[model samples]
Target: MKRILLRLINFGKKLPLVIKSIKKIYRYGGYTAINIASINYGEILKEKKVLITGGSTGIGLSIAKKSLQVGATVVITGRNDDKLKKAADEIKNPRLKTLKWDISQINQIEEGIKNTKLLLEGDIDILINNAGIVNSITFPNVTEEIWDKIYSINSKGLFFLTQTLCDQWMKEDKVQLKKIINISSQGGFVGATYPYRMTKWDISGLTQGLGIKLAPHGIIVNGVAPGIIATKMQPNYHAQEDNVFCSLNPLKRIAMPTEIAELVVFLMSDAANFIVGQTILCDGGYSIK
Candidate 1:
């Protein structure tokens, strides 16, 4: 009897959501599966050169793949040489290139950017600062070593890399518009004491600042803050192949890396040129919940 009553209460609570969904379906002429036939491969990113950090796996890898599919020359950088090679093999595209770079090492920023430009034999038109680390350590449990480690890659490294690239672009007297897409996390939108979330806050702020500061120079800075994505960063979510469910999420499912990649591709293309330093939250309503 108790279990039955509990189920009834839960059903009652979800009734509004169900009704809302039904109304949306009916109003929008019902839902349909997104088939390949419906997708238009217009190659919106053609003739573009892109560079993605932490591109050997997960979200970065997905973004790199999509960018290449849209006819962009892509260069992916990772800390591991083996992983970079493996990603290159998986993509199997002549326009895809890989560089072994550790973004945390500030000393290597200039050299890495120079080498990447040399590999492309041209200036990078789009730079995606997607390389970041996360930890759950909070409040009293956080240590200085851990904080430094997270900030080095997530905040400091990103700042210098963007500055170096902008300086180079300015010196070259390039007339084409440049784009920088920093990958932050949905955790940034909340009040959290963890180092990872704190670093993400920094990313969100930097995106706005750089977006305004660099606009006069034909550079647009923006960011994507994804929530509960199924990636190695979220081990529990990534392990399940068929399971996309997430009870905590309002949508009842975590986002896939491909979904975030699509948003990134749009931001990189000319379609989003007018969009300034705003970090779009691709959290599937998680932040609001």
Candidate 2:
């Protein structure tokens, strides 16, 4: 009888914790249903034309695939012709085309756009500035070359490309509701610790500035800041079948490239026109911590 009473007391002590767990489950579980509703499987992006930078692999590749699936003609560009060919072959869709262009070469932006137009067969309706490089070197070890290398692609290249495209789109007056979706990093939102994070911060700030400046021009600009994702870039977690080992993340698992692609697709869709100048952080609640 004494043992039974002791057990009852222990259960009572844990009741509050149990209740909190249930509440957390209910909140996140409800988000799944809401997310399902947000996904418009009715071909919301049908007949649109999209251009994705660094589309040879990872998040860019996933976005290209998803855009194609939603009835959009897509042009994916990369610096490597071999990888571009491989990505094209992997997709095997007539509406999908590949271009070889190095975005870091700002001088060749026009030439690259010309070639991209040739493959796209017309001007692109949406531009995805997803091409970027990372330097994991920390502050003490960081060099000027490392900082410039990262910025040349992630910030400078993206800015110039958007400017080039916007110049053309603004003059056309025929195509309405153009969109630019920049792929930033969740690290951009927090204090920076490296060159990569600093570049991302620039991207996030540029996204907001462009959103305001370009709203009157009929172009909507937005961004997606992703946390640690399971990709080749994150070599440690890339090959794991179940990547739930992240201690800093609230969700306890890294996101897949496809997950980021889904959000990109949503941002590109007509349904998200009202959302501008905002970089949505899909970081599994990592920034909150």
Candidate 3:
């Protein structure tokens, strides 16, 4: 009788576990149904066409390299034909192409976009305006020529290039979650010793303004503001002892072009679709300081 009673007790204990298992199965089924209903019937990142300005070197080249790694067909633009060709060769991907044109000239930008379209074979899925110049002059010493040079390249060129791309995308009617990633600088956020900061500030404003205007078209615009990155643009920092410039940042270090490139790649990806109109500070906490 004792053995039978013990067996009954064991059966009773297992009854709750059996009920829990059934409940879990039902919950899983409901989740699966919801997941099925929310499925996206489109490709995520494969075979997308990406265009990047100033892509022959530095941050732009880094972004192109990462984009190509993710199965994207990349077209890079630069003023130097040899540099562009070298960058394309170094990437060593069949999906990579190079175009030579000076972005500072509006006429050159228009012709370059036309040539780029032929190379890309369709509207660009992603456009990265990574070309910019920095004039290391104090306010009092700033020249009109220098100011114009900075504005022409950093502000006017970027604005029109993006406008041309948008016009083409509209004409083609290939509106599949397009993205525009502009490379701004920390100088734009705070006072800097360069007149170029004015141009960068404009870039930040354009990023936000265009994000709103482009949202209805399924396009997102954003900017990445990098601080004290180790690039050709700042060769003086490299020559400094102890790299004291990096110590100014809260992170106490400089950022790599690849690090900034990763953020740009993410901004262009579908993973960051909701991250619009924001200028992400990839400055290793420099802005905080």
Candidate 4:
């Protein structure tokens, strides 16, 4: 029966030719043939080596989990060792590695990347800079220290991380369609009542500029600007008797971390090769209103 099945499979190879001849007789030859050829060249999303910052919880954790589910090797970093250990155990994937590092410390980034690279066994194919901080104080109440912390983590850290990765990619001559997905905020695109918005705006600028600078080297830089995500960060605002932030969006609800994660995965995948220098708004249309 196995031999018979093999013979049948061999005969199936001629089926396309027969169909093409029939199409030719019907005066629609090339269309069907082109469609069949295109099918043969269909692309698949294979496993990648990915590094995500701030992956102990929230959107970062969500992205790490989804990357592992899609057969990628994931390396995650956070400032808290306990949270990193707990998250690693919870993820339960042998391909996932966790590191503890605070991105705000530029001096630590080199060591962080080296450690992450060792776990990945090479340069990362995708880098997701999801580490960020926020404060709820009004603009007038914002202090120099608050601005410095936010910018250091959200903008400066992300920029330097991408710089280090790109340098490594160039050194290794592995700059073919590499991706850098920066996690920004809806506040970057609209007015917000936090000093953190300034950092996110800088992220938007860096993403666009990096997209241009790296495009020649086959690297794509893009961002995901999420709005009102239902994460632990939301409680920092302290403005609501209830979850009033949920209703502030046009969607009338806050997004789950996984929703934003899916978008990050897509942007990092082959599906988004043509999508470069863009900040995808994954806020359930919240920015529109």
Best by lDDT: 1
Clashes of each: 0, 0, 0, 0
Each candidate structure's TM-score, on Cα atoms with residue i matched to residue i, is 0.86, 0.85, 0.80, 0.80
**Candidate 1, lDDT over the whole model:** 0.88
Choose 2 or 3, whichever is better by lDDT.
2
Q: Candidate 3 local accuracy as lDDT?
A: 0.80
Indicate the TM-score of model 4.
0.80
Q: For candidate 2, what is the TM-score?
A: 0.85
Error of 4 at 165 (Å): 1.6
Best TM-score among the predictions, by candidate number: 1
Could you give candidate 2's per-residue lDDT for residues 41-86 as a string of tens digits?
5787888889999999999999998898889999898889999999
Per-residue lDDT of candidate 1, residues 103-211 (tens digit): 9999999999989988888889999999998998899999999999999999999999999889988777777898999999888888979889999999999999998
Model 1 ranges off by over 4 Å: 1-41
lDDT of 3 by residue, 139-226 (tens): 7898988988988999999999999888876666653788899998888788766668888888999999999999888889999999
The sequence of per-residue lDDT tens digits that candidate 4 reaches over residues 1-289 is 9999999998799889877666544542122111111111122335588899999988899888878777789899988899999998898888999988888888887898889989988767889989988877777798888878787888888888888778877777563678899999888888866778878888888899989888888889999999876577886322222232344666555666777887888888888898888899877577787
Ranking by lDDT: 1, 2, 3, 4
Candidate 2 lDDT score at position 200: 94
lDDT, candidate 4, at 231? 72
User: What is each predicted model's overall lDDT from 0 to 1?
Assistant: 0.88, 0.86, 0.80, 0.79
**For model 3, what is the alpha-carbon lDDT of residue 42?**
37
Query: In model 2, which range of ten residues has the least summed lDDT?
Result: 29-38
Q: Give the TM-score of candidate 3.
A: 0.80
